[model samples]
Target chain A: MSAERYNRQIILKGFGEEAQQQLLRAKVLVIGAGGLGCPALQYLAAAGIGHIGLVDDDTISLSNLHRQILFTTADIGKLKVEVAAKRLQEMNTQIGIIRHPIRLQKNNILDILSRYDYILDGTDNFESRYLINDACALLNKPLIFAAVSGFEGQLAVFNTPDHLTPSTNYRDLFPIPPDKGEVANCAENGVLGVLPGILGTMAAAETIKLIAKIGQPLTNKILSYNLLTQEQYTIKISHGGGYTLPKTVDEFLNMDYQDTSEGPQGYAEIDASELVKLQQLESTILIDVRERHEVPILDKQIFTQVPMSEFGAFMSKEFYQKHVVLICQHGIRSVAAAEAMQEKYGDAKKIYSLKGGIVKWRDHFLKP
Target chain B: MKIELISFGKISEFINNQNIEVDGIADTDTFKQYLENQFPALKSMKYKLALNKNIVQENTEITNNAIIAIMPPFSGG
Candidate 1:
């Protein structure tokens, strides 16, 4: 690397040749090449991090261009990892950019993650987040976590250095995943174009700080920032003292993240189109679990009104003869209702929860 | 004792109010039970409770006149 290219950060008070050397030797693996990864990768590359890995299998769609700043209009159909790598390489020829153009699944995460000195999570789902956290903990690698939704963003440093006072991981923050449909994705809820940019840049700053050993990193704590109100909150996370994390790769491989004994909970769930198919059968019954007062009420004649609170009282063996579908305000409650019904009735009934409930139905079947 | 409760992100949308004052809530666990009972819609959503700017594990006690916050995972990025 040229001296002129790195002089600005090197001349800073405490950071000089020693920190610059550390940054040049540090290796980071960033998962997800969408909104958050773009800005993080750009900054890390520009900061002259010696080796960086980019992982994402998604293609750049036109919708992503508004928030994903790495690519232009012409790069829409390209793979995110490839495009990001090329751009990062062009930005800093001194840094090494490795592209993994595949999804981060349990099968390959261990091998790929072990190679990096640090991991930065820009993933968009809970499953991936948890998986990455476990892998990082098992490997004793520090992770920089960032997430954005709507007008808000959150950043945290998890599984920090052993020398730190006390360290915490993601599970300590969110004990479990939110039930499906309980939380909406950016696709469903929408987000401010700049939210991820701000958060991702913060993520990059944390990474640079971790490598360069500059200021205090956000380890053992979480910082939530809301762009709308311009408010920020930081909360300390205490070590839950140590618990059993997946110790071996095989244990992680055999891990069943879906559901318990009765098998995958999602198996008993059906999408909107499937509900339409089952509706044609005479034995199929659609039960609306939403309260009567809820808006855009379903037609009373076509569906039975059995609010979830009263769902237990209406159960019977005869319901087993038909394909019973539970519907609620959104898909989440219906699944909960279906699980309760399944517990009471066992497998005798062909019970199904409407995947998105009336909200999806209204969007697809009813609303103009 | 009175405590102020705050919620953020989608959890805030479900909660509606940015801040609320409550009395007679004993600890973090009781406060959570109160929240779930009051807003049945929150039963399924995942969230963390922070008492006075500290994230507490389940059943941790809440001191009087503290600020409690409800936060869910912001998984958008």
Candidate 2:
């Protein structure tokens, strides 16, 4: 290791040559190359975390430039993992940057996560959050978790025991994943560019503290930051119950993390053609969940007008249909309705949401 | 009793960031029940309650003038 490169951090009290060496020896895996991942990776790389593995299957788009600082405008359409790895390598030539350009799934997450001593979760979705939390818990690896939505951001360290407190995982806070469309993500709610930047950097800071064994890491504690108010608070996370955590590898693999809220278990998202096929079946019921005033209206004879405004009332009424197909303008509301239906009828009725909604399949709906 | 109710993320949508006065509620369980009853939307949302910065593992007593924070899990990057 070049002593001159890390002189600033090494010269600081409590963090010296030994602490810098510890950072060089640590293996950290950061999942997600978007907002949080980008900033965290930048600092982790510059700090010379010896072996860093980045996991992401996302391709950079024009929309990602505001906060995803690693990618340039010209680098748009390139794989995020590839671009991030290249930029991080340029930032620090001494550290080894391993790029795993793959989406983490139940089958692949364990093998990849097990290789690293520390795991950083910067993934955006609930599915990945719960999956990584459970996998890290099962693998006995310390996890640095960070998330940002709208004006607020959250940071926590999971699966790492603190003095007098046994460790706490994500599930200890939220036992079950919210319905897929029930809670809005960064894409849906929108986030301030600087929000994730702050949270991600703090995630890196916590990781560094944990690695260097210096300051107290946020183990079993969650910190919430509000960008709008510039107010921040940290809360202790106690061991929570009422949630099932897969204890064994076999149990972990068998657990349905993929279809947690929607998909095979809850509801299926289908296309226009599939809708037509299901239309022929007498048991199928097509419900338009769009607000009454919106859209080139569907045929009243076919679609039962159940505006989402009064969906709560609609849900209470009994329906005879075995297959329920929900449609809306952009298909977003339909998925929400489908989720509600799925929760109400479980496996008794098959619920489906039109993938692109009526707007995408305008010709099919407008046909005489 | 009066308590400062601080909410973060989506939980703020249901309960505004302010000081709320409660009369009948005595513990975290009853306080949560009252809050959810008042803000019906909160019943569907999952969040953790912290009293005076310490997360409540179970139904704990709510002391007067205690600072209570409600935080929901954020799934964003």
Candidate 3:
């Protein structure tokens, strides 16, 4: 292949031959093989980026075919990274493609991410978004970040400082995540099909700007788009007062998500397994606070019947006489109920929630 | 007291055309209060309040000549 493909872009005075070669020598890792990732990966591969890393744990579900442009209908139910690399390889084998089939976790993110020069975030979940930001902040790597929901999308560059630019990061814009449930994914509220396409293309443009060093980048300002009306707006952002270089990725990782949980807070008490044994000696009452229709059914007659919704306003503190154990499916609602009881009853009745719920107890405690 | 209040993004569009005066403009605190009064939505959104390019949080003392910029997070691409 000749340099003719990039010749037009390279001839521009600022990004001439040197920047084109930089593009040929750079490696980029993209997380999330969903809607955003597909478009971002497509343009980067077409632009002759040097090496690309595709990390995703999801399989190509039939529902994703609408926006994840890389896969075919037949590719549904197949591993995303594997098939994505194959398609990308078929497009341009000259660009080295490494597919990591594992989910991005705190333990493996550092070792795996250390290899790439630039990162593009396409993740849809907060846990993964935090991991990406923490890893990038710790590694001092330039990140082209983008997120989309409904008819809106945001694009920005984090930690990329050039000769004339000052350092800026995600926290400079949003010091913390919104309360959980404030922003719902497209799955719940619905999104225009073309939203991610516009955002991902801008993300690709930003990546080239960061590498080419030619155009103005969205460093301290965030560009917001409403594709429904073809409207565009931008907001200027500056560093927050408490912003500082994070000591370790762990320090950044430990930054608590700013109250994004918008649902009702139900608390339950999960207790040590031995407490149930001692309670048996003390004749403790056990309450099953789950609805009768959840998975992992238990056969113990020690259980009491009480659905979470009805548990309150129906059963009084008199129901739980001394120490009581609360159980539920996955331990979410039941523990919440136990905490409510603890608040009402206080030290008069000791309430403990079984951790990991009944399934955990069956596996760890009651195994034959 | 008189002060200029400007809101950007979605919030800006809502208040862009009206030439309105807010009563009880005792201080800058009242300026934000006036905004919250006009658009009930302002109370729900977390905004970066700026006084002539200086970032200010809630409870910031208002100067009579301050030009306040109310900016909200634009999460669109």
- The candidates, ranked best first by TM-score, are 2, 1, 3
Model 2's lDDT to the true fold?
0.87
Q: Top model by DockQ, which number? A: 2
- Per-residue error (Å), model 1, residue A99: 1.0
lDDT of 2 by residue, A1-368 (tens): 99999999999999999999999999999999889999999999999899999998767766689999998989865789999998899899999999999878899999999889999999877888999999999999999999987799999999999887898999999999886445753124677788899999999999999999999899888999888888889998899888999999999999888732243225777777789999999999999999889879888999999999999998898989999999998677887788788778888998889866776677889998
lDDT of 2 by residue, B1-77 (tens): 99999988777776788988879878999989888888888887777899999988898998899999988778888
DockQ, structure candidate 3: 0.26
Q: Per-residue CA lDDT of candidate 1, range A88-190, in tens?
A: 9998999899999976777888999989998999987767787888889888899999998788999999988436456678888876666654676323457
- List per-prediction Cα lDDT, in the order shown: 0.80, 0.87, 0.68
Determine which window of 10 residues in candidate 3 chain B has minimal summed lDDT: B15-24
Best by TM-score: 2
What TM-score does chain A of each model score against the native chain A?
A: 0.70, 0.74, 0.68
List ranges where model 3 is wrong by over 4 Å.
A4-15, A162-165, A185-188, A242-245, A249-368, B1-30, B37-45, B49-77
RMSD of each: 9.4, 6.7, 8.0
- Clash pairs, candidate 2, are none
Q: Any runs in candidate 1 off by more than 4 Å, and if so which?
A: A162-164, A185-187, A241-244, A257-368, B16-21
For residue B26, model 3's alpha carbon misses the true position, in angstroms, by 9.2
What fraction of the reference structure's interface contacts does model 3 contain?
0.17
